[model samples]
Target: VNCNCDYGCPCQFNARPTDGTCRAVVAWRIDSGHFGDTRLDGLHAVNIYAWPGAIHEGNGSMQSIIDERASDAQRTALVAILQGEGADPGAVMLQIYRTMCTAAHEPLYEPIHLDIDIAERTARLSIPGLVDSAVEPIRNPVTGAPHRARVDLPFGKEFRLAEVASGRTRATGVIPLELANT
Candidate 1:
């Protein structure tokens, strides 16, 4: 995930954004999963979002991009899951995000290239002509030594533990974004 915020996004802590607005591009690569018997392993998806104010204030724009290699059934299942269908209300993060957005653009099918190594704190994601993003370990400003940190949310719906890293993103789709060191 990359956004127009400082290295540690304040939003995660329920704080306002660094700037007064919010814009982010988040991508996920499913290593192993199933959506109603439709295998979602090795598939990738991306979500781009922007808001004039805090997320809870509404009036946001969002778009989804899915891997073009997925089959028809896989595409349908992915779309359904991402759009928050067939899940208990507000149980999934995507569902909550969808409700906060006023504009939800049509999903796009595109070629996606994603490589992630969570243990190494490195990731690279690219979609031809659409988005390019990367994640890397954070470094100390003075010593230039790699800094490691993690956020643990015991009851969080989105995740239980997350490694904090630096991220950069450039997107040129319906919801364009250019984020650095976020």
Candidate 2:
């Protein structure tokens, strides 16, 4: 998730979004996964979305992008999963988010660039014309040293735990998402 949430990301724990609203950039690099017979391995999926109030508030909008390298079966499966169409009700984070969205723009198929460095607490993901986001270690304002932190979600839905850090996102497409220092 790369939208405009605070550094602590209150929304991760069922709390209100830091900005009184939610703008989320959900992305993934599926090195290995599957949707039934469709091998979704080596695929990338990204979704940009926004809501006026909390996530519980419906009528939101979204734009999805998938790896163009995917085959027909892979594309269809990925899109359906991203749209939360072929899953058990509320089973995953995407499924829940799908129920809250009202408008889904036409999906984009394009090459994706993704890099993840977990030990360094850094990542970079870009979908041309849609979003450009980066995550890095949080810095100490006074000393300018990299601040270290982590969040351990023992019973989490999206992730079991996360390395807390500073992040920024610039979304210039239909979703219009933006996040800074978080």
Q: Name the best candidate (by TM-score).
A: 1
lDDT of each: 0.89, 0.84
Compute the lDDT of residue 139 as modeled in candidate 1: 89
Query: Which runs of model 1 end up more than 4 angstroms from their true locations?
Result: none
Model 1, 1-182: lDDT tens digits are 88898866787788898998989888989999999899999999988999998888889989889999999999999888877778777888888888889999999999999999877989999999999999999989999988998888898667888888999899998898888888
lDDT, candidate 2, equals 0.84
Q: What is the TM-score of each candidate against the true structure?
A: 0.95, 0.92
| Model 1: pairs clashing at backbone N, Cα or C within 3 Å | none
Predicted structure 1: clash tally: 0
Name the runs in model 2 displaced over 4 angstroms. none
TM-score of 1: 0.95
Residue 128 of model 2, lDDT score: 81
lDDT of 2 at 20: 87
